[model samples]
Target: MSSQKMRTAQIVEYNKPYQLCERPTPVCGDNDLLIQVHAAGFCHSDLQVLHGQFPAHLPLTPSHEPAGKIVQIGAQVQGSWKVGDRVGVLNFKNSCKSCVGCRQQLRRRHRTDPRFCQSREMAGFKHDGAFAQYMLADPDTTVHLPEKVSFEQGAPLMCAGATVWGALQKLKPDVQPGEAVAIVGIGGLGQLGVQFAKAMNFRTVAIDNRDEGRKLSMEVSEKLKPDLVVDSSAPDASDKILEFTSGEGLAGIVVCTDSIQANAWSLEQLGNGGVMVPVGLPKEKWQFDSSALVFRELVIKGVYVAGTEDVQEMLKVVAEHDITSHITMLEFDDIPGIVEKYTDKAMKGRLVVKIA
Candidate 1:
């Protein structure tokens, strides 16, 4: 395969469609793996990169959620990884291991924070990503895919799944079992959040807006089985949530939509001492009531994608619980169409490209 050339979807300019072109397969570095991508999940963030909404280095390949089999291993790479090993690539390609966050993660054996590392490199944004037949990955940032998880299921876990998993973790040690937790937005992340909340023994309430959103929420409930579903478009959305929980209000709310209105409304539904985790990146600035936050002692926290350990734990949860992402599969050549759909807000769940 030394002389092999692979097809890639390259973003040659901002606000432009990806150009499908052939390029030489990337060479494996000493601590890297050459992955033959089987599936790559399209994200709303990728659309942000394309539309110049997100800061990114130009001429980038924009699919961060990728899963595939290792085709080549670097000489220095070790520990169970070999040719044919199934794996999912993480967004953080590499991080400076000497930073405070890195030192904490290394010493604690869990990720406290590594996003502050000055040397962090992000796939699909700062470097080339898996929107192609083959992509390069650092072994340290890649997780082995369990046999029970299909490539399509494993792909979105790299970003969407791991993201919500990390966000849900923020509620830990505070949110007790049987406490009602609300997941706002029934799209890709919210759907996964509902499953994670249920798996962790939390009473899950799924919230969405409008008739279309209500229909999508119903579909998700049928598949994932949340405890309750709330349509924020209703006149008494907050009232219904409080009534459902017997006036206890939600213990925590995970805001998965990029709509500012949804985020604001979710904050109002939180009970005293409740936490609101905003996982979505809305282009507009958020405007919520400060007095409500102060009087109720509500907490609003932001989370990026998962750390290395979080990614591993997320994968284990998915495998152990038999969780699967609701994804629409398309061919590699259908990237243009998928991007259009995302821009047009037509995507329901997740979209995964069959690269292999």
Candidate 2:
């Protein structure tokens, strides 16, 4: 293949194995950076795109969590960004200034974040993403990878870390430091949620049914681990949490798994006036009794992938606190294997593909 052609693992059809093909390398647009793809991480969102649960352009390359070095900088890009800068790319791109999210006078007051604007370009879903030798990245949502963080680790942080970081941020106004915050479903995002909660000085609790998930919550981070680990499958699970908090229940809960049962179960663990943030995208409808909201005054809010500033701040925390993603590194040749293992019921940690 010529230098202009790059190998890509494309979703040529829904519910099918990825097709490896050589396609012309994407050109750097005026507002984009051409990245020499090194690592791409698979998450639940990738599985959704693969199985056609999410709308996607056909033959799209899959992987929203991508990390690499810039090989070419767009002419219109500002700042110190240049060739050879290691970076992680978020999925959202090209915000339309005319959209409701962008046109709001106050960004924080906007009902929808500009990153979720309907007209925005979404890598992996609407455009070719990192499962390739090269890909285009929007500078707006990209962050530089620290020297302490590797491409493999940075890849998953783009989604998993930023997402949990944003979810935890939502709890700050309601839950004070040293208050109890439980991280439900300790896997890729959950593991990080546990760490980030602790880093934020919340009394962190890790909850998961799988032994591996519980074990991972305590093992993933060197400096920070949950204050407690609870087996959600235990017959006395809710009671255990209540006992730990002195019958107050958790001050806040971040639901990271897509299981409707898990999400519903999390709602029962929150104290009165507590908040719950659901970051997982589940296909099944999430059902909850209205009594909890009315009687407990509980707040449940949805979070998509975090915005650009949040991602950048999340990286800073990861670097400062020595936070690390528990990653399973695989070769680009094993794209199919990556997809298969990601579907495992007990899959723990993030699966990252080395594409270089």
Candidate 3:
């Protein structure tokens, strides 16, 4: 029997529950590496895929934000990522490696190069993923983790954290130290966003409505010493932003919440030319008047997860600045309940599932 038949997660449809079963441990392709997942975070994105918001090949294994140890590699893969090396997984699947989009975004280093688009395949979305005991990844596309970080702490950095990093970098180029920046929805992605933004020398502020989440946000803020913190639940949250900015307006705002209304509210609160970057893809269209964007001279853009190179550079950034995520660990089989528990509003912070 093929070795892969020893361990795997069975998936029948995009909307169905994930079933755990024995299958061969997946093998690494010529450009790939075989990973033994020690921990894979249950991202909200996974829940989205479960509900069909994100398309996937039927019977697909669903997981992207994973951290683990590398056990084997295909020929031509290098960079000292040998067996037993710590690693983190990013959300991007393989791109054509030659298409414009792939060149521009598949690998962060290729963002400036116009010749690198196109990918051969994708993981989680286009093929099987880390929901199983083993997953195959292209060596060119994986993120290496440092020894200092634990598996759970490194899990969300693979996806949620990378998404936020990409969004924040897009907003604050040469981010002025102490500039005020706001992070919407202090959960899985937002929590890490707060830490990274604060580390970048920006005065990070987190906006969320849940009392527990708000408390968590404040707790993180206290550790980082953001210039100001506000509760989205307050009737006058907008006023609070106004007060905090002293009427000058925020330097930049990232709408991490999935609520279109909250995103629209961000535009109104923006200072002249303030950039509003959306890291979350709401189910429906972004509800807002086109005219609102033109008059304010606002720049609104959305970011997909991130590219291979972005993962590498981001790791260096995280290490140099000491950024990390608030993660909760569960067994590999806990995926079903993990997805079921995330109501539209109750879920916050990243949940890492142990796969070993």
Best by TM-score: 2
lDDT tens digits by residue: candidate 2, 1-356: 12488889999898888888889988778887889989999988888888887776688998989999999888899889979999999988877767766676136555344475768888887778899999888787788999889998899998898888989999868899989999998888888888888889998899999899899999865558888899999999999899989999999999988789998899989999999999877767898768988899999988777787788888888888888888888998899667778877767799999998
Off by over 4 Å in 3: 1-4, 100-120, 289-292, 320-322, 344-347
Candidate no. 1 TM-score: 0.93
Q: Candidate 1 or 3, higher lDDT?
A: 1
Task: Give the RMSD in angstroms, all C-alphas superposed, for model 2.
Answer: 2.1
Runs of candidate 2 with Cα error greater than 4 angstroms are 1-3, 105-114
Candidate 2, residue 34: how far the Cα is off, in Å: 0.9
CA-RMSD of model 3: 3.0
Candidates' C-alpha lDDT: 0.84, 0.86, 0.73
For all predictions, the C-alpha RMSD in Å is: 2.1, 2.1, 3.0
lDDT for each residue of candidate 3 in 65-176, tens digit (9 for 90 to 100): 7788888877977677788889987655545656667555546653332123354555665577777777887676677897777788887788787788888888856346
- Model 1 stretches astray by more than 4 angstroms: 55-57, 99-114, 220-223, 344-346
Best candidate (score: lDDT) = 2
lDDT of 2 at 246: 97
For residues 185-235, what per-residue lDDT tens digits would candidate 1 score against the true structure?
888888788888888889889888855555565564343578888888989
